[model samples]
Target chain A: MTGFDFPPPVMPPGVEALRAEVRAFLAQSQAEEGWRPDSDFGSDWSASFSRALGARGWIGMTWPAAYGGHERSALERYVVIEELLAAGAPVYAHWVADRQSGPLLLRFGSEAQRRAILPRIAAGGCYFAIGMSEPDSGSDLASVRTRAVRSGDGWRIDGTKVWTSNAHRSHYMIALCRTGPAGESRHEGLSQFLIDLEGDGVEVNPIVNLAGKHDFNECVFDGVTIPADRLIGREGDGWRQVTGELALERSGPERILSTFHLLAALVEAAGPAPEPRLAEAIGRLVAEFYALRAMSLAVAGRLEAGALPDVEAAIVKDMGTRFEAEVAETLRRAVPLEPVAGDRDGAGGNAPSLASALGASVLGLPSFTLRGGTNEILRSIIARGLGVR
Target chain B: MSDETLRLIEQTADDLFAAESGAARAALAKGEWPEGAWQAFAATGLAQAALPEDAGGAGLAAGLAVLRAAGRHAAPLPVAETMMATLLCHAAGMEAPPGPLALSTTAAGEDGDGSTVRRVPWARFASAVAVVGPEGTLTLRTPADVVEGANLAGEPRDDMALSGPPAAAGTLPPDTDGTLLMALARAAQLRGAMEQALAMTVRYASEREQFGRPLARFQAIQHHLAEIAGEAAASGAAVDAAAEARTPFAFAAAKARASQAAGTIARLAHQVHGAIGYTAEHDLHHWTKRLWAWRDECGNEAHWWRVLGTDAGQGGGAALWPMLVAAGTAGTDAAAAAGEGARP
Candidate 1:
């Protein structure tokens, strides 16, 4: 019988030192800056904080040194990112570029594009937003109506991408567009281009989320022109390039630790010696977390060894996202506190931080399973992996 | 052991059990010990695989791999219990008794009424039972009588009434937690059981038809099978990680995860199989029933959850992170030692 293989990860050497470095940096940043720790990665964006991580050589860690990377292993990068995520650090500015765009460029971008954009990304001076989702397309990405036609020495893109997080703040967008006939398969004739978000005929309109945040944007491209070299990989190979990185996209600390601050807060509220029942609740979540981490690490280890392990990665995301959502619901019952709108001060005469963290998590819960492909989509991917569909 | 050797050992054990599947089940139905199967397995020396080289055994990795295969086949004998007994005896500086064995932890009260040690797997068939106390004291006993009991899988779980003093007793090695070891054993078995259940369900779903297409072609059915696959994978990874780590916390997490997966995997497996899987005639029950029984064996999800939660909550919230980070490397030395201990 066929089965998923998650061999034990061979951890990179000297990770303890690297873990120490990340922890110390987070502690110093929290103490000195006193930034309100975001409960999740996408909730907050701080350019300076991104720059701080970049200056420490933590971004683009696994890429070549020629592109401002540290030439570190993926496991090392995993250590840094997990540490940052667990602390709820403001990693949004460089998150997309560091996580997906930079790696994509390293894999499929031209040398000129790499030399130009990768260094900026590693330095945390530049950021990117995904332009795959459009007004007519979310999970059915192949149905995107965005069109990029060949113009003299360049390409002209015209389309609107919805749910484009941070499109306003990002420097560039990797837009997937139909460059040729649909042919027999809809996935055919699609291409990805590096469109400058600030170029002419581009518009960014804010779409407020349930949390009263402007993280989501609707980006409109009215014939925006990009250089011919901006095409990522080969034209019409967009589907493979995008689908190839699901393992990298889905199986990360971000997927699991999105609501970790809530769990941490619950632990804090439980105090030094919680009741057995409350401890059990906490322990239940921790046990799930422990197992999920091992699975995630196994996938990461496989990725570092150049194996996709996409099925295993999908399992991690499906379970990890559900676990993330479960944390909030469990904490609501486990911790007897009505979530308050975060006041950002102690004037409320209550455990404001716990209540506020709980509040943020509850509000952010919907996106846990929605963003980065909904749980249904992930389950389908897992089923395909099982060869049952 | 190298990956190649481990694969070879597991393959050998799998072949042996596959060949014995019919006889093992026949013995269970007849209410008699499968003496032939027992002798055939014992001749392999794989039972002592976890003992040190000086003790003439393979290693912990080999031993756990063998347990996994035993779980896959739901081997009727007390293979895991015997392995634990052998390891306990070797740890206590004593040679294990020959024949099928079970490890028991309970002792008769001072009242001396000969009240039985309840639910010890294959206890009636065991030539000797190694009882290890919480403080690492090992007492090897030959039971005076046995009352037959069975788990949901119809595997022997007899009650042994101790009458006289132990035949042999000694102190186990320091810091050895018997319950944790048993939990690890059960978790490994659960991993194997869940995997087998998933494989069976996937095959059934692929072959069975409804609405003019295979059941696997249905989205709803596919999702159910997918969830089962996730649980199985998580359980397997958890057991492997716990074995490699060998810490009490790691073992607790493994057992909790496995026990947690058993319910969902069993339910989904049966659901995908429809009426056929629920019947006693089908082989799927061999795995599902064992999953239901094995989950509550060492400790259920609630029991281990408390242990993990309490350990996680020490020294307030800030201390939890360090403890978790430390847990990643908690028992690496023990695991590495167990691996190298059996090497020449």
Candidate 2:
């Protein structure tokens, strides 16, 4: 039998209370700000919104309270993230820091780094972007030519990271730069350095995305010197450390709930007593959402049980990302949505609310598969685990 | 039930298939009944496993596991139908009919106006057909004068015209959902069939050689297999969730998800298997064809999709997520419960 097991995760039933709390918090927060939910949760960055969430003790929920966290159960965190993603909240600003970086710092960072960063992340005042992808190295993280050479008691990082999300607006970045020799293993001798975005040698150039948004950037690191303490984990432990972070990044509700706004819109547009075809389409999307959420929650449970569900995480990412994209395609079929370039000012036009949601979803569809880890890469991970090669 | 008992059930089902299904599949494809296999399946108590403890049967989950095994083997004995019959008969506090059984919800004319259910599965072989409808549950002996029909899988789906005096077995409770129960049954079978298809495809991809290497070495085949893995895994989770919860929405979602996956899986498994999969000689068609038949049997994607979708649609935009949560479990929602009762 294949070694992968997604045994229906057994979570205590108390998470419903947490889910209720999250829903209530979101309802009150969204109403108070008069903020309508959006489809593209990945690129929607609202620092104030994140701080409000942090004040509610939602950010870094599962981490320890000593680091400005609530020290709650993993399911509670799952509820928080699940609600945020479903509501299509502006979670992008503190998303990276809260989801992976803070966790990574708690596990692998120096004491001082953890003290300086974890509380700020829990406060939603600190934001971080992943610096794994480079101009030439996308999925092939080991081939990153960006070198962090040792200098006078510090490292001079010099590499250009492309497709760096939120780097222009974020406070810091965790760049996976080569620190030492490649040796025999291609993954050897690399290191992750915490780069301050406002550092002297750093330049952030914007890359307009399909939605014509300024969420992505090309980050150039030219002799950006940082103290040795800025390096996350040991010098040669970058590959393993980053893999763990990616695992944290991959299996979450955000991957599957990106187009939830469109789903709600589709149901609303169908009105009461829709054609059988329309109702079925809406039902199918909701069904897929339910199934994927179940799977995602199971994976989360596995992670909470202190097992690294790398293969399971890959399955969730591969399936969850595709499910999000399929939501857009099915929405197109349901409401005839078209992809239109917008300057992020809500695509102002006479387009119906359904059409606007469809367009937003259509624009974000390609990123669904491309971001986090490409479907191709995640599949390779699954293939490797399946012993396909 | 303890894990040991469930493992025993799985082991017994596994041994039964290992001893019989491998040889009987060819005969089954030819529309010949596998009597030996059927006897072995019944002897193991899988056919009557769904009956309650007072009725001398295993639990629902245990029986579902066996049903999945039956599907895994593509066992052509109507084991799933027999299990359903055993449960219905037990629920009615009546003795199960002899031999195999079929199920139908089609209403029969009381005055013998020749109203008949077409494609009643295994009608020609079964001793009785349980006709469950909103009116009541009627156990009708399989009429001798029946026109035999087979689905894409060549399983016996004979048309039995309503005739003679049928036994008034029992009445369904106001909340008993024949459709949802059948949907869960078919979903379990689909999950089992898809798992086998995936296992077969993965094994084939690993062994079959192309371009001086195993087919698994090729990225194209790997991606296809990966997709199959995702669908199979997701379907498995859905089934387990529904089985664990046993709620109306859970079963509905499971059926919809499994049926949705089965549609793509049949094609992808064949695509991975290439031209050889098209032939009847290969064992792949038995499962794939069964998937095709099973996907539409209890409730296809459209049937159950619209059921849950109309509920969400009727609830309007603000009620969407809450409706989803309520639909996923037997949550405290009077409106959603009302919707569940009204589902066909």
Candidate 3:
């Protein structure tokens, strides 16, 4: 009824303190370790970088204490993630685990699975790769042919998952597989299994991205055995589980901050006195950025109150991703200087900031729109929410 | 005006328009003026919503509220134009048009026959056309419909063939006020069209698919669609800021932003709709066509930008920041003023 009058995103009383702690930790880490912040590494996967964050009890901050979590609010976790992303800290190592896997296990995983996996996630020692997209199953996730036949005490998984980000480095993966025959509903007969990447019969083959980096992999799960308890939630509920996971995945600061580093770089390159056009563009961008941040916080607030905020989340993601892409473009057109030796190579090499960010951003941009759900899907949700449809 | 009064005005207009115009369908089909609809709106005190309270109208700042409802339903009646005319008349200390009158305006021009006025569009549908002459005098005339060309909305244009006893005309100084008001009205129409286009595309995307997943699942599609959302939101904010400013410059910026956004959005909507969007059978074209016409109607993007650019240049380069701050802070009330100093 008013200006974003929803519940405040659930956060502990000390969440601001937690943010201050993370900021101090990052500042110290940058000073001591002399880490070179790379825009190309949108999310860092450095083992050392992750363990340092874990040491401060920042990783898996929202899970129960018994599972090595600090048992904080989701908003507190959101604050930490926002700070980490803004600082461009290398956080890819435990990102998936902290973001969704740890929470997923706590919710639907068996006791043995939670006990075995979550503590490592909180300690930042474990990593997880999503095994949803296959070679032929890019957007058509329901058509995945990856199958797991029931064995004596476990299931034998034999299929290849393509575009599996960080599969080579991840300790384990939660793969969606067909455990039953194809039925009337394509969404039916699907189940998710937590497979150990280091286990026997599992192969992690590198798939080089367009940037010539091994950020993704083609994992072959040939006769990979997972114990009966490895299945997440009830059988045939994979669709519902994945949908819930997306609500978490899509409704975060990540959606808007993808091009944040580029913005910083552009500002730095522009110097204190910007050209009139450039200044105006930056000012407009900043206004939209603030509005989006408020919108995202509102969604986070909704989710913290045990509400889905599905349509609102979609709106945030939609607006956020566009702003990200636009920032990259705006910087490309505004700045005239090239990166001096150490900067990453982007497309065309003319505008490296745009190129480097755009290279990852363009490839990654598709997923931003399509990943959690397409913009079109989100709009439909918004339309329904507004009662216009 | 208070929120309750605004709500009441919106509800009354929405109800009367729905009943008299039958949700814009009858107007869209017959191209006949909804005289009854106009009378109902006048009865509800919306015909002069922006006039002074002493005038025979509600005298409330109901611009945004009225625009939102009109945009939602794509109502074709000239509510915004009528309100603008009423405001201008009140500002000039002239008696406002009364009893279901459609008011139109045009820029000043020279004509030996005392007929041609510069830059007048949609002059045929007006009961009376107002023209600002070369001497800066505003002249009102009731003219024949031959001068107004065919309008996209199917309504008769308001172009007037002027030939009458020269009536005394009011004068407005060289400022952006009149142009700004016209631009705001057009921007409101564009805003409505943008919302409709977004809704149409989203529906199409959900029901249609190419590679198993809904077309909405493709990242490329989502990215384009997301851009549309961003544009719409930005334009909405800009329009609101302009309306709240009640100044020529702010409204000029809003008009420029809204016009550009509407054009881009319309093109993208058609792109997302693909071949189906181009067809007449689909109602998507109705909104898209209106967007194209509206963007170029009151003032095109190029014209407004040139005006804004000239104004900024003339005001000196340093004035840009303060102007921007003023524009951003235009819409906030007193309670929201704490952070006002922190804006730019």
- lDDT (tens digit, per residue) of candidate 3 on B1-344: 56598688767665665466554556546656666666667677666665545565444246555665565456667776666665665555566556433444332121213565433443545665555445435556665534544456454444455666534367644332444566677677677667777777767777787978777766566656665665666566556554444445556666667777777898888888999889878778767777777777666666565555444434332233334334433333221111111111
Native contacts present in candidate 2, fraction: 0.65
Task: Sort every candidate by TM-score, greatest first.
Answer: 1, 2, 3
Encode model 1's per-residue lDDT on A1-389: one tens digit a residue: 55685667878789888999999999999877766665488867899999999999999999899999999988898889988988878899999999889998899889999999999999988999988899889999889899999999999988899999999889998888999877787788998888887765579999999888888999888888878888999999988888775556787878888888777777777876879898889889988988888888888888788877778888998999899988888889987877765565453431336777778788888998988898888889999988866
Error of 1 at B30 (Å): 1.0
**How many angstroms is residue B23 displaced in model 1 relative to the true structure, after the best TM-score fit?**
1.8
The reply for model 1, stretches above 4 Å from the true place, is A344-352, B52-55, B106-115, B330-344
lDDT of 2 by residue, A72-146 (tens): 877678877877877867788899999899999999998898889899999989999999999899888889999
- Highest DockQ model number: 1
List fnat per candidate, in order: 0.65, 0.65, 0.01
| Poorest lDDT segment (10 consecutive residues) of candidate 3 chain A | A1-10
Ten residues in a row with the worst lDDT in model 1 chain B?
B335-344
In model 2, the runs with Cα more than 4 Å from the true position are A3-5, A199-201, A336-352, B2-5, B27-32, B52-58, B106-114, B136-143, B330-344
DockQ, every prediction: 0.70, 0.58, 0.05
lDDT of 2 by residue, B76-139 (tens): 7777777776666655556777788887743122112346666777888787887765554546
Regions more than 4 Å wrong, model 3: A1-41, A47-80, A115-125, A199-201, A267-326, A336-389, B1-16, B20-39, B42-66, B76-189, B197-258, B268-286, B293-344
Please give each candidate's TM-score: 0.96, 0.92, 0.64
